[model samples]
Target chain A: MQIRKFHVYLTLVMFSTGFLMASSIELTQSTKKSRENENELQQEMSLNERIIAEREKNRSLEIQSLDRQRDISKIEEELAKHETDAAGLLANLEEARMLAGTVPAEGAGIVVTLRDNPSSNSQNVIQNIVHEQDIWRVVNELYAAGAEGVSVNDQRLVTSSSIRCVGPTVIVNGVKSAAPFVIKAVGDPDTLEAALHLPGGVVDVFDGFIKIESGKKENIQLPAFLGDAKVGKSVS
Target chain B: MGQNRKITFILTTISAIIGVMLAVQLQSNLHPLQSESRSITELRKVLLQEQEKSKVLLADISKQEQLLSQYQESLDSVDSIGVMKEELSRAQKQAGLASVSGKGIIIQIEQDPILNEQWDAENLPLPDPSNLVLDVDLRWLTNELLANGAQVLSINNNRLLSNSSIRNVGEKIQVDTKTIRMPYEIKALGNPDTLISSMKLEGLEEFFRSVNMKVTIEERENLVIPAFNGTKHIQHMKPIKAKGDS
Candidate 1:
């Protein structure tokens, strides 16, 4: 009976060993196949990852390009605006220069001449003489009549010009002048003549004492002023 | 039996770990961006930065538009403004806003020295006003100069403008409200030869001789006339706007 029992135990041991070896071999083969499959899956996963990374990179670059384009347009618009501003500034500067009398004036105008009565036999010379008030009256009237430019003896009359007398002679623009005053004005000759010849006008006032003659011409040129372009000074 | 049980336990643990890893790999494969939360956070940051940049750019554009509008206002009516400026400047120069200098003639007037000496000392030649240089006489000369193409004139350093007046205020000659003395000097800027010839043509020299007044003429190549020093106060002038205009 002990021998039979020992034989049975040996059989059981062999059977268990055989079954374990077969299963182990099968498990090894399956593991080897699974390893190959895992490798293929890992490769596919890596490729997908690379594709996703590349797509994300492309999208980011597109967004950056759009932002840059917008910035370029904004800058271009600003540049255009600056160019316009520059043009305006230039225009203003040119205007200022002209107004300051730093440039010459040219146009059509009239010349009015005044002379003392040659036949004045009056014992009182004052009555026969042309007074500063007379010229002033005529000049004021010319301006009133819309004279664009007026000069007495080529001295460009500006807003602050003064006509005065010192003793026997009349001083204008700081120079001495004698009889036969010539007043050149740049304007419509007809308008200036009409303005002077208006009822009870400058001509009427000086009718007896002075001989007044005025006529229009085609071309009149006035020179640039030679005085200091002093700041803070202007004629009303 | 104990050894078999231990082996069984080890195999089961290994299988469980492999299954869990496979599940995680599959999940990652399905959704990459979501599975990697870091990528989502990075993209969100980039988007926010881009949006902020665009916002700043938009603000800049708006600011530029405002500036452009201001510039446009000045640009409007540029041509008319240019013409107006030219006209105004011409008027200003004629009004004596600037000093003028040019080649011209100077006429000097004074009492006749020889005639005064020849006059009887006992009679003292009753200070005849006709013989004396009067304000009216100066005014006549000024008017004559203006008529003869004098652009600017000055009497004894006084600049002549449109409103300057020569008057006799008692014994003193008042020019532009200022009193002046003898040997009056009149400066004029023009063509010197024409001015001299014009005065001669008017017989001014003979006229001066008849009145016992001495006149001397000198032509200068370069003369400077000063600007008007008086103030012009306008009390009743105002601009008129056109209809339907701003």
Candidate 2:
């Protein structure tokens, strides 16, 4: 029995040592590779830190702009309150601004999200990625179904709005955004949802390609158009 | 037996050392990105994104400041209503609710006879003259014109509004919810030279030529795009109550 116990203990020690040696070899190679790339790693890390800092600063600036916008709205409300004749004018102006997408909007609507196919392979990259045409198709369906307001990735659709393809990303209202484009529409949620699922509509067209999803939301808030809305001064 | 014990003791100690080393290696692997970062290109992408956002945010700040001062001036001035009218007109123009005229280009896309795509080796059903210039094509055309400085646009007399959509419904193409049949006339109120040059650069003219689309881009001395006559409402989108919140 003592001899048997000794054999088992020796085997256990040998097995563990063998496993450890294999792992150590693997680890050493990777560690060496990492050491070789240490300089690049350091540079990348610093770059990441700077990006984070820049983003934080932008968030604060965004808030500043939003605050000022709110203040202007409040003053407009005061004016509309005092001047009865101007009430109609202010109301018309607000409607026009809403249609122009110059102001923030929120109400009963639907959100259509298109993301790159999860099973994307290199061979089918074109089919797997979301294109500007796909976005336009969805937007077209929404408007056809009587959507009153629409925005893509928070870039509100305006008269001068154009979705331009720039490499892999699309520029909506002159602001570039990538795939997984969230399209928010303000209208009858049921009508908007039904329009997309029509026979050979956006759903069928994007079938083996992008992942499209449409859902009704009680309230979908879209921001104001941030791009310059001023036309060419030469236009008379 | 004593020899066996000594050998076993040595093995045990060696294994213990190996076990410690393995743990250290595993720990390091677990914290692989403890230094943290993706690729260099990814880092640059993030940096450029922040820069673009910063640019937009800064522009928004100045715009808001300007609007605030204007509102302040109007509120204090006796001609407050007049100033409000100016603001209203500005919004109206931006919304394409007012007529605009300028030196621009007019594009006419008419159908021509063409067999089909060479890529369709099986001779699939025709993407013939009827479906040659779909709404997607029109959208790209519109994008090109607008990107190259087209201020006001109308497709088949249907003003392209902020909420406009070009769509093909049952073989009929519609712009801004109104059916616009083929032989489309797209009018743009902007610099004609810029629009035409950009169209050529996009190879749009060439592509249309190769297909069943007979396209023409002409420089008009004065192109007028009328106000959007379609229903404009704000039923669903209520301007979020800005008050009662910071």
Candidate 3:
């Protein structure tokens, strides 16, 4: 009976050890798959620290920018109050500011959003990606249809604005933005909407490659060109 | 007794492996993401936002500096009117209201000789014209020019303003509503050598040649980019006053 009891205990030990071995094997397999991710997580922590520091720097610079902007505008307002051509020039200057996209604006317009085909089964990936040409097409169409003001991802398209593609990101007004580009143009909402919807229009041409949808908004707010609109001397 | 001892040894080894696995699993749990569930994608999104904020704020600081210096110059001048007029003209030029003439480069893109030959030979059923002057190509070219410091740009006399757009509309290319045909002449006012070198460096001409388009780049001393005659009236966009007192 003692020998039998010893056998029972040995069997129990073997059975439990086998179970533990099976479960641990599965656990280690998953952990092996996640080891690369562990390294990434550590890198992500460092990235977090750097971003926090950058944001703090930006906050202070923003305050300094606001102060300088207030001072310049104050002088401009004072000068506009003076005699004759000054007021007219100020009015023209305001109009130019609108043209230069130096001031924020809001009006009835249409918002067109373009994004990558989420389920694109196309063999050519490059064709499906949103190229700068794709953006130029839509913006051109909007302007042709009489869009008074246009902004791509809220980066106002100034004379000097260059839209280029770098890797998977598109840079607008020198700011990097990923997909789901939002283009807002201040114009007759009906006209802009119809222009994009015309047969073989921008939406149709970009059918398989990009997914485009537009809506008319009563109050489409657009920010000013945050980038420098500082122009050098125009040689006569 | 020997058989029992060998079994016991095997069981101990197996348990030892299990212990190591358990310790490793515990270690992984202890070293989870800071938020416990944040994915790499979410972290990247936050990073991109922070980077954009920095870029915008940096540009803002520089622009404000330009404006402040202009204000000081206006205050220092004996003739504030002259200073305001100078500012107005500069704004006008940027708005494409004032005509600009200077040293720059002209890029012309048109149909290849083979394409016209094929069109004539193929008759009504043209073989899927591929290399015709595409608006996208023009946009790319003009963007390249602009990137190379081309201050003023125009397509076929249609001066590109701050809001100007070049687009392919119904088989024709339009520069802000002005339809331009084949032999697209793009005029850019800037440094001639810089523009020419950039065009060459981009291998735009070679790329166009391979794609069945004729490319001509010329450096001209007296290229005149006319003022934008198109009415860009500030109809919809109401300028938000910088100062509330105004």
Best by TM-score: 2
For lDDT, candidate 1 versus 2, the one ahead is: 2
lDDT of 3 by residue, B12-84 (tens): 7766876786687577668743453666686677778878778877877786687567667664433666766
Write the residue-wise lDDT of candidate 1 on B1-246 in tens digits. Answer: 665555556556655665665566556546543332234345544455445444543453454354334434444444434433443454456556566677888898777878667665556655666456776677678777776677778898787654455666667887765678988888888789999999999887788777766889999987777776655432111111122211
DockQ, all candidates in order: 0.02, 0.46, 0.38
The weakest ten consecutive residues by lDDT in model 2 chain A span A227-236
| Interface RMSD after interface superposition, each candidate | 28.8, 4.0, 6.8
Tell me the TM-score of model 2. 0.76
Where does candidate 1 stray beyond 4 Å?
A1-236, B1-92, B121-124, B238-246
Clash pairs of candidate 3? none
Residue A169 local lDDT, model 2: 86
TM-score of chain A considered alone, across all candidate predictions:
0.56, 0.72, 0.70
RMSD of 3: 8.3
Candidate 2 on B156-214: residue-level lDDT in tens?
88989877888777677878668888789999878777788888888987777665577
Sort by TM-score, top down from the best: 2, 3, 1
lDDT of 3 by residue, A98-212 (tens): 7877667778999999888857777788787788888888988898788888889878888878888888889886677898899999999999999998998888898887889
Between the candidate structures 1 and 3, which one is better when assessed by DockQ? Answer: 3
Superposed on the true chain A, the predicted chain A of model 2 yields a TM-score of: 0.72
Ranking 2 against 3 by lDDT, winner: 2
Q: Summarize candidate 1's per-residue lDDT along A53-105 as a digit string, tens digits.
A: 65565445434433443443343334336566435443443333333333345
True contacts kept of each: 0.03, 0.69, 0.59
Stretches > 4 Å off in candidate 3:
A1-50, A74-84, A120-129, A207-209, A229-232, B1-31, B34-81, B100-103, B110-131, B147-151, B168-172, B189-198, B201-203, B210-213, B220-224, B242-246
- On lDDT, the candidate that comes out on top is 2
Off by over 4 Å in 2: A1-46, A116-129, A164-171, A174-179, A204-210, A234-236, B1-25, B34-42, B75-78, B101-104, B111-132, B147-151, B169-171, B189-194, B220-224, B242-246
